[model samples]
Target chain A: MIQGNKKKFNVREIREQFPALRQLIYGKNLIYFDNGATSQKPQMVLDAINLYYSKDNANIHRGVHYMSQQATNGYEDSRRTIQNYLNAEKSEEIIFTKGTTDGINLVAFSYGQLLSAGDEILITAMEHHSNIVPWQMLCERKGCVLKVAPINKKGELIMEAFDALLSKKTKLVAVTHISNALGTINPVKELAKKAHAVGAKILVDGAQSIQHTKIDVQDMNCDFFVFSSHKVFGPTGVGVLYGKEALLEKMPPYQGGGDMILKVTFERTTYNELPYKFEAGTPHIAGVICLAKAIEFLSSYDMEAIQKHEIELAEYAQDMLTTFEGVHIIGEAKKKTSVVSFTVDGLHPFDIGTLLDKQGIAVRTGHHCTQPLMDFYKIPGTIRASFAFYNTKEEIDFFISAVEKSINMLR
Target chain B: MTLEEKQQEIIQDFAIFDDWMEKYEYIIELGKELPIIQADKKTEDRLIIGCQSQVWLDSSLENGKMQFYADSDAIITKGIIGLLIRVLNNETPEDIAKVDLHFIREIGLQEHLSITRSNGLVSMIKKIKMSALMAV
Candidate 1:
């Protein structure tokens, strides 16, 4: 376990957990700033994956043998672990998915397929394509109207516009809890309340939010919450979709297959229980097991303390970036995550990203899959450096120095 | 064109970046290589909606092959478009469809591409491929 002292979250110790962090890029220690895309997995998560495949590999649930029981136990145990992590009402509410994209698609297909024409689905101006496209597809297919709530010039959500958009016709409200492109921490609780006031169910895309904040679906009053495990230092190909039991039971099964059914019949078939109904075929067993390990790793740390450390790093980065002559920071909302999106004058973002890569700093450059938001902002893209709990202030200094050098070189 | 011929052409053009610091000069040089679209052809139809630079791409099929002509108002973007055209232009629809382009990593270009530029490149590729498929 990492020590709780202020300096105990050493970059060396944190980097040690992620073997990839030691890798040399341009003969320098890799400073990964692309955590917004996907986080690097720790050795513990890797070991969990290896252990599962090496020892406990078997078909889960149906088999009566020892290996089967072990596999089943590992899989179900992960569900319980995640349920506790999210403070979900029950393990049945935790449905394993491929990732945030799959989770959103599942809800859109299941809950969305049920909506009639003239119903409205409200999403915000700043949503990842995964959140926006699925709902758009749903509205397009179901003859429902898709309405967007606007945002301010600062990339903050316009609450009044959101309020005006909400009506009794609004069947479902799907919005991102955190803007992956802008790093804005949205008022999802307020959005949820607004949706529920109009008798509309809400789904919070928690992919970016879950990493930086502690989430309680009950407290937020969101009907569904979706997040990818990869964004939270867990293995790729695994995610969680937490739906209220009543909502899960009410909606149709997302996909048809073996595990999702109660019984096989030539005439008629009934779907299985809450989670299994959404989980079709053989799921990502190893990834799910490792996700539990990641959740365990996060639970060990004091979340408030970690958040404080990250905020400090973010503020330092913001200050350092402001010193650069041509640098412009995007997304200056009062509430934000540890993402800093900036554009340097005269240097294209791609050029900046390339030069940064040479300096062993990995930052995401471009629109970040938020083309609509980019269109709204009227910029091609910004070089984005999103921080994780494991990042350090020294790394930020190195990053700022690199940016300064890069800007100078480009100039 | 044969793969060898394409390689030769790219190698010949690669010297244009000998002085990387003179980016504006290289960008202007890249702009010169870009084939011009007719003034009447300039329309909202040709404008790539997401780019900060005013980029216009137009395509035509000849002898069952797709050909692309693109220009960008921003100089470096023009160079990027030229880079893209070097890789993608004149390929068969089937060949273009199978090209993984993970080789962008080999040439060390992906690291240089911002996610948006990467996405724009992807969107451009997708559009080009769609046009090729239409031609086919």
Candidate 2:
């Protein structure tokens, strides 16, 4: 459904599409600023979820019944939608999994099989634990060496250090396109070029970048890209892994199950073709179909406008936060998305967070699953307010006042 | 006051507040007034396991009565700890172990009591009970 006035981007109209945005929390209008964790679903996606389970529910890929075929078509069409979104050359390269963590593990377990001892995997200091732990586990299992590139105090990757770390021994360079805890957008395209120069393949963890920017795997020349549907206004339990066709064909199947087998015999077993080789059980069918609706919902708006709006919100919040006496902004990268993390002198993040909760403003406060980054900053945790496109300056205004009140109460 | 009487008194104090603001303001004040734990008692063994804030709780049995002291990095958690100690301090070990902390829920601060809340108050309460049981 076209929202009908595409000429000018109207955030209010876009906000209307999300039912969760129109509600009350503790008698105040809910000001949700936790988008970096997950996004609220548009009504279209919610409706699609209900429609799929109510009408078209069936096991996909092997049944000859009408419902099964319809379910299969919806699931495949969703793959094509994601393929077009990421500009992958073929739909066969899109492998659906549980989410970003699952996608990274698939590469670690399957692609790790091809690596021999003494091979190296290079990652950055700012990667989320999901990206770091998989490589460590792979190293433990395969005897590959794990190397980390340093980031400056500003939370930006030190290109000199990254360059020094990349060598011929490096077989894989796994990094996040954007930092979840710091809102730092890494130079993935440049990093990809450098990795290729060293004869190493790069995997871009797009968990934070997919919703905020345009992604073209071919344009970026990344060997692998992964993102979660829930972070892009879709349902949870579904994710996409976009790998180069040649690389995917070379890697062994991730999981062996009913759908991932071409034929099984007592003597020998052959794996199914490209995409199916990775998808094991009956997948999250309703979630996949609803994710397509989410992508469609996102496609209706101007992504550039959304990106601009989100950046404006973050900048506005950061500038307001800076005016306060003891508020210290954590990440001040040259290019950042919709995240403002900070610490206050003589105040704990958990205290501030609890005070904000009483006032009906939702923000995340903790280590944010980046303990190494927290330790680098020499702080326990931070109070983070991450915005989405549907948010407005009005919500930021309320959030700022809430923060002030919370600080006063905390002090 | 008896333990049940102390709980009733706290409930009455909270009932006077019209909204969450007034209640939180009082809690923050209580948190600010919470006594600091002795430096020597802040050992790793006394640290609670599940809270987002680091909470150290120490207890002793003096003359068959329970004596509890606690501290936290967060003021709100400190205030909540103040409430817990107010009711349980100086009670008998059997009473400390057997008493239901209904006052937490009665005062509309039940979120902290939830098992999913990582603030470690639940763990602190459990530890207090385990200590009380040991003393018994």
Candidate 3:
């Protein structure tokens, strides 16, 4: 019913697609600026979830029944949906994962097994803990060197320093496309090209980028890309790992289980083909189907216009909020997405968060899983407001005033 | 007021404010009233790690009654610590160990019970009881 609107990118009609936006918290309208954490699901995605469980519910690839065939089609079709969305070379290049963390862990465990003690795995300082810890664990397991590329005070990666860190010994480079806490957009295409020049593989953590911007993996030329479903308004517990086909074929299966195996005796077993080998059991079938629906839901809108609206909100909010005395805007990168992180001078982030929460404004506080980045700033944390396309400029005005009131109250 | 009377009084104060904004204002006021701990006592050993925000609690026994001093980076957390200290400050070790601070839930601040906020509060309570138990 919501999709019946003919006007392109009618945000009011688009906002109607998400039922969660209509609710009230603390007797006030809920202003959900936590898109960095997770995006609200659209009605079409919800309907798709209901459609899957109600009809196409069965074990895929094994059962001979009609339900199984239908279920398999739905799952594979969703894979194609993601393949097209990412503009990947082939559907086989897309592997279903639990989330971005699971995708990275798969590469770390399987691809990481090939590395030796002297090999270096490079990452950025502004990465979320998900992007950092897996490589750390891989390093500990293999005795490999983990090098960190530092970011400047503006939260942009220092490219000259990054080039100094990259070497022939650097086996892999894992970096985020956008900083979750800071909203800084890294130059991934250039970074990928540089990694390739050094004969190193690069993995782009697209968890923060996929929803806000257009991603063409082939154009970016990154060896692997990872993102979560919920971050893109799809259901949780489902994600995509887009890898170069050759790299995926060479890497061993991530898990040994019923679906991943072709045949198994006591001693040896052969693994399945490209994508199936990595996806071990009965997957989050419902979630996967809804993810495609979410992508389709996004495809209906003018993505560039939506992106512009979101970025404008961030810039506008930053400009307005910075006017408040004692407000220090963190991560003033020249290029940023919808995220805005800041702290009131001499006031704790938790205090600001608590006061905002009282006003029904949901902003993320604390280290935001980038404790190292928080350490870099020499602060406990910053109040982060991340906007989605559904959010309006009026909400930003409300948010700025609420923050002003909150800072005043704390002072 | 006695510990029980003090807790009852605080609960009554929170109950009057239906608006969350006002309730937080009340909590921030409570935080302002939190007795400052000495700079020397703010040692690493006294800090409670793994709180959503940093909390430092200093606990001791004086003449068989438990005494507590605490601070937190978050105003809400400081106020939460303030509420706990106000109730159990002058109570005996036996009483402090067993005291039920049910007013947290009764006052409609139930979100604290579900996350690390509650964990931090639990650790705070555990530290108090541990101090009391050691005295006993």
Candidate 4:
């Protein structure tokens, strides 16, 4: 239904594509507002998953059998799809990973090989733990210095602080494209430019942004861009790590295994070329093929219309929440995505989340794995209701009333 | 009353409520009545940090009976904790360790018992059991 209309975005029709959204939870229609964590997969993606496993189940890259060749083609086709999705210079730059964390760790380990002791790695405060910990481990292993750029109360990155941290010693600057906990969108393009000016490479954590906005690695000019496929309506356990071909060639292979090596002996081992050098094991074949289908599904939509719909839903939710006393919305950035996080006075987020769950409204409650960000706000956590394009204003209205009721019950 | 009888009493108390809202409202009221743990007892060692909420459990042995006092940042958790204390309090440590408090599921809050619930109730129960086991 959504594929038929290219220009107009009909959310109801789009919602119909996701089978999981139509189900009832606890005798109430499920109102899923946890899109920031992960998105619901479309029927096409599910069908693609089933089709791959049913017929094309074979080890890719080396199998001489027709099924193996077919699986290999499917896997390579997905890499090309991701390369196109990110607008990368070459398909070789798109390496399949376990997920966003694995992608980041790959870069931190492989790229950290290039950095010397006392060389600095810079990151922002709004980053997810995935983006932070890899660089921390890299620093520890390589004797490199890790510096954090701060954020303001609005959850926006402090560009001045980021600039202050950038220097000749700063070999790499890693930042999230969007704040998962707060929905604060960081200006990766500008940050990339600044990082380059200091002769430092930049890595953009696109896990949260890839689903909400258009991502062009070439345009952004970030040396590395990483995102989880599951967050973008794809299958779990697969992700994409897009890097500059030149940079990837210079870095050591991430893992040693069957596919990643060309020749191996007791005394000598030679690695494979480009992507296979990093993709060591037999990959998640079904996941990769289905992720391509997910990208194709997303490509059918007018992204501008989808973004508009989602942002409006978030704005409407934020506005309604303001009417209630002692309801403080976290991360009120000017360029926020479809996420509204807030806490009610004298009420715990866990209590509110439990009540909302009983009403069949799924929201994320707690620190959201960004403990440093929560500490900055001096909050235990906030109740986050993240929206996707499939969500409606009516659902937000229901959520607001549910929140009010939850507050009343909690008080 | 025996521990089983105490659990039955809670089951009966919850049986009057037709829906989850009524049951939870009563639980919230019970939360209000939960005796607050001493502020000094809210130490790091006593703290059970669930991803969703924080629970502080302090226990003592009073004349060979287990006495459990607990508090949580979340009221629903505290209410559940109050129910836990109600059934298990004044029982011998051996009995507290062995008791099966099935009223939680009978009352339709089986979700709380799940370790994945992220409300510290599972760990809270574990801590209670460990304390009882240690005393035993």
Candidate 5:
């Protein structure tokens, strides 16, 4: 539905939309390449957030008054907007969460009961701690086995190894669609199919992929998917969890609170239906509404065109970084997203990151919550520059020059 | 110099740098000049957790004077520790414990005060005081 008659992306026009990007940092034009961590919000999103609190300021799903009705309608309309965005079969399957971390925890708790002793839950070496830890906790609680699928030297998941791990005992396979640290895109659709063959459910961690690529849950046939809105240029504390109807209908409610209940009596309290049962309490009402606005902003453009632009930028940056003497770019996957992670020889990522900060170049340098991946690569951490469509080749040229200068100083 | 005098000296020393770049170069120079931590003392127990960059700090209290030997995987962190060490080293535990590290702010090392680096900085200060507290 997002695909339609679209104009060619104008980096100048798009850059104008984000007011934060218009400012200066340390006497240099701000060059933000931390999109993998979080993207800057467009003016439309900021305006929407302001509009919500200023005009429609009421808790959703609880009031019968006009303002409350309007608020509730806006909130549900957000769910429908997102439902259309992800192309989920029904709005009932979409659950709002605090972020990717909270979404994973909810699934871990709600679905943990399905696994028993000796049941194997599969994950990958490339998962963020969010995707890995919840299953680790679930395995600990239920006496299940947690198996990690290994990756190749190029940071791609080994499909043969993954196939070997899947069997009758394999109860679930949870993996990231794109590695936050490595930027390696997993063949999630094929993996999802393989997971189902062994009677195991699969979960695609869409935290990185949701913003960079298009998602069709039906076409992919994954059992569940989770993503954060903030990474896609929306506000923080807002995330989405998409679960198939049959599975969600079977699972119990995630949290106990005001709106998640049908009735609360001392004698007996029953839970509400799907989606609402998963979403607890007075949610990030304003954040979700603004998130829908962000999605609306995204839908205005051709996502395919945006994705292509981002990929080209990343490729160009990667090519430039490779030419630097003693510079190593991590995760050379055959298929990747708009992220280039690298480390200079004999220089800590922290030092490079600090120097880059002085020059107003924003990049993330750490284990990126994927410490296992770092251990595999035999490094402490790498400097990551992630791109968004709003970025331009001119910015990349400036980034390369800054990085080269920073490296020379550190050396 | 007294601990306050030393901190004041550093504050005065950093005021000459016109921009962040020069100030950073000075910090990096300080990092390079940090007293070497004994290789044996660089064990896991001496390692400071909760830091984005790995840090190892060791303390020795002899004849009521405290000495801190530290190293970091990141140069900026090492430089930060060097700044702390310059002021606190060779002072009495009570003096080290009581002194406020005002030079950090006065020198405009605002990046060290940021949320990401603040944990490491605070822990370093706490460990310094803890080493002093143990001797007392």
Candidate 6:
């Protein structure tokens, strides 16, 4: 069993929950540090999936049969569970999507289609490609101008520049709450408020933030919030987009499909209600049902406890990483999630990632879909070790030791 | 033509990537073959944006075929460009335009490439193709 600081939860107990984590890679226990990309699901989440497929499999919301009612109830219950997890006012505001990318594209296509020429869309330089590309497409199509809020050398958002970027002509401010590449936890509440003051709608890409931090959308008061279920230990192919009821009502449906339309005739068509209008066609029913189980697993553990445990692990990893000669950690922001982005002097990031993988330590390396940020740092790419609540300090120590060995060998 | 026939014809004209691992080594060796771009050409105009490495690419079209001159501060990234040029060079603009180099996945390079290298390969191919289109 993995050894570490003994806490309320033991490593063995936690390890038992994830069957995939038990597998050996390169004859060593897997030390997964790519949580920011996608997390491994626990048995509960997996079981939920199996149960849905085997016992409750049916098309939802249309049939009067028992299986259909059960499936529909399970599906809707998952939506309510997600609503409670996000603390949204109502379930109608939550629209299921494929993932964070789809969520952002939905908003961009629906709301961005309304934007006229000369309208401005403000986004930070630290955003993931998911946040950046959709807006760029909108700008190109609408003849709208795209404005970027730059980050300081420390990889923190330049709040002053963000404020300056907001203007009367700025129609939308789309930013990531937590940067996937840099691990910078942006001051999204303040940024959202500033955008609202300038009469711009705000779309917070909470893909990274929702996994690590406590999010109160009501308190943030952003117009739209988006997150992926996979990043939060749920199933892939499912995500959430929480839009305020008033704004969702005004926006047109993104895709013209069976579920999104209320009535269709030869000449005229009327759209469905708010969330359904956004959710087109058959959804990822099994993934959605299993997402609720993942949420339940997360809710059982106090967030503060999880944050405390992860912060300790991150700090330990950072200290150990700094001890290696010629190792420089990128994005030294005062506020960050448990992600350490670093570059070794003599070795390329790819070489480092490959070497580490040989020892069963999995870390993400490269631009991480944020080429613009890599350009700012003036580096080829970084080796990113992102942590989750389940990751232990001993695993981080093993990671550090492996890195030292790899660097020594490579050099 | 059949897939095999088309592949054989292409293979006859250019080096086949059938042994991609060996080809990778050859590509890296080709990075060594590249004549260094002059310090004067390392200006903003030659700089390839969105690369993790400080890469500068410049190309000239001769007799309707593209020849690329590229360098990167990172050796492996430079090697990636060499590999890209090997596939992309000597092809007509129309042929290059028709090829979906995303089929690099078939060579099993995607699984091996770091995301940056994958992206760099993409950019390098795009720049070379765009240069070809411009020449045409």
Highest DockQ against the true fold, candidate: 4
lDDT of 3 by residue, A30-81 (tens): 9999999999999989888888888889989998999999999999999999
Q: Is the docking of candidate 1 incorrect, acceptable, medium or high quality?
A: incorrect
Better of 1 and 2 by TM-score: 2
What TM-score would each prediction reach against the true structure?
0.83, 0.97, 0.97, 0.98, 0.97, 0.80
Tens-place lDDT digits, model 2, residues A1-411: 344643357888889989998988888899999898999999999889889988999999999999999999999999999999899999999999999999999999999999999999999989889999999999999999999999999999999999999999999999999999999999999999999999999999999998999899999999999999999999999999999999999999988888999999999999999899999889999988888888888877778888999999999999999899999999989988899999999999988988788888888898888888998999989999999888999999999999999888787
Instruction: Compare candidates 2 and 6 on TM-score and give the better one.
Output: 2
Q: After superposition, how far is residue A1 of candidate 5 from its true place, in Å?
A: 19
lDDT over C-alpha atoms for residue A138 of model 4: 90
Number of residue pairs clashing in candidate 3, backbone atoms closer than 3 angstroms, sequence gap of 3 or more or interchain:
0
User: What is the lDDT for B130 in model 6?
Assistant: 78
Candidate 2: clashing pairs of residues: B51-B118, B51-B119, B51-B120
Model 5: colliding residue pairs: none
Residues B14-122 of candidate 3: C-alpha lDDT, one tens digit per residue: 8788688888888888888776577788899988865457778897778878788888777787887887887888889887767777788888776765665543666
Show pairs that collide, candidate 6.
A380-B52
Interface RMSD values for the candidates, listed in order?
Answer: 4.9, 1.1, 1.3, 0.8, 1.2, 5.2
| Candidate 4 runs further than 4 Å off | A1-7
* Candidate 1 chain B lowest-lDDT run of ten: B18-27
Off by over 4 Å in 2: A1-7, B49-51
**Could you give the DockQ of candidate 6?**
0.14
Report fnat for all candidates as fractions from 0 to 1: 0.00, 0.83, 0.74, 0.83, 0.48, 0.13
Clashing pairs in 4: none
Give the DockQ-based CAPRI class for model 4.
Answer: high
DockQ of all candidates, in order?
0.14, 0.78, 0.74, 0.85, 0.66, 0.14
Model 5 global lDDT (CA atoms, 0 to 1): 0.88
For candidate 6, the per-residue lDDT at A316 reads 91
Per-residue lDDT over A244-336 for candidate 1, one digit per residue giving the tens place of the 0 to 100 score = 999898999988997999988899998898889888899998889889999887777777877888888888999999987878888999999
Q: Is the docking of candidate 2 incorrect, acceptable, medium or high quality?
A: medium
The residue ranges of model 6 lying beyond 4 angstroms of the native Cα positions read: A1-11, B1-136
